[model samples]
Target: MNTRELETVWAPRMLSVLRIVTALIFLAHGSQKLLGFPASDGMPDPFTMGWIAGVLELFGGALLVAGLFTRPVAFVLSGQMAVAYFIAHLPQSFFPALNGGDAAILYCFVFLYLVFAGPGPWSVDATRRQRSA
Candidate 1:
């Protein structure tokens, strides 16, 4: 196919892939903190910032993966990532690399993009729109 055609055909599919993969990775962070499944040092204490972040990451990531309520969920998750970077990483160093917050920064922008992008064409949101129209 031509370049334009390829882009047209694959762009939405790629967006869904991006959403799923990113959510899977983000979910792992929550699992580590909450369930200790990948076995971090230990689970965070209940209702602490770390534990709260884990809760959001776990549930928000799941919602994002399904593309359910994608825009609002992405907004909240994006905000969470931003707060995580500032609170956890910025104090350590000015540079994201040095602070180990590069992933947080990336996730922040990506989720923000999803907020604007409307979960592409492979989401429950998309299906709902299609049905309602």
Candidate 2:
């Protein structure tokens, strides 16, 4: 296949993989908090901060997985992670190496990327656009 054709095929395939993987990870984390599974110290309590995070993760992750409303959902999820970093992770220490701040920071950036770049051409939003056009 020509380079252009290869690009078209590979890009969408990669994006689909990214969408599913990120969504699953987010869903698992959110479910753990929502269901109170494993019972970690950092896990948020229901009807509180945990509840908010759980909703964001669960719904946002679902949207991401389906490639629907990806940009807005990713933006919200990014904001949520930023808040979590500042409120929970940052106060502990400046060094992520010492604490668990690095993971939160990483999540923040990843969600931010998704917010700006969106779910790409493999998303449901893209399909909807194609249909409308």
Candidate 3:
């Protein structure tokens, strides 16, 4: 196939994969907060920070997975990670492996990337565009 045709065909597929992967990661984090799957000591209850994190992760991740308002969702998630890093991780140290700092930094960057790149051509937004055209 020609380069243009290949781009049209594969680009969306690649984006779909990235979206799914990122969504799953977010979902897992939400689940941890909501369900206490990993049994974290910080699981918040009744207007606690953990509860807020759970809600954001669950809803944001769902929206991202569906490719609905992905940029906004990713932007929010990125902010969440930024807060987490500064409040919880950075005071400990800058090294991710030293504490949870690394993970928080990584998540922040991933969310930022999603915010800029968006859900790509395979998303619900893309479908909406197709229908409108």
**Strongest candidate by TM-score:** 1
Q: At residue 92, what lDDT does model 2 achieve?
A: 85
Clashes of each: 0, 0, 1
* CA lDDT for candidate 2: 0.81
> Model 3: per-residue lDDT, tens digit, 18-82?
88788878878887888777666657785787789898988888888889998888888899989
Off by over 4 Å in 2: 1-6, 37-44
Cα-based TM-score, every candidate: 0.96, 0.84, 0.84
lDDT of model 2, residue 60: 84
Rank the models by TM-score, top first: 1, 3, 2
- TM-score of candidate 2 against the unseen true structure: 0.84
Expressed as tens digits, the lDDT of each residue in 1-133 for candidate 2 is 8999878788778867787788878877787777655464566666798788888888788888888988888888889988998898878888887768776777788888887777878789989999999
Q: Which consecutive 10 residues in model 3 have the weakest lDDT in total?
A: 37-46
Global lDDT scores for all candidate models: 0.93, 0.81, 0.83
Candidate 2, number of clashes: 0
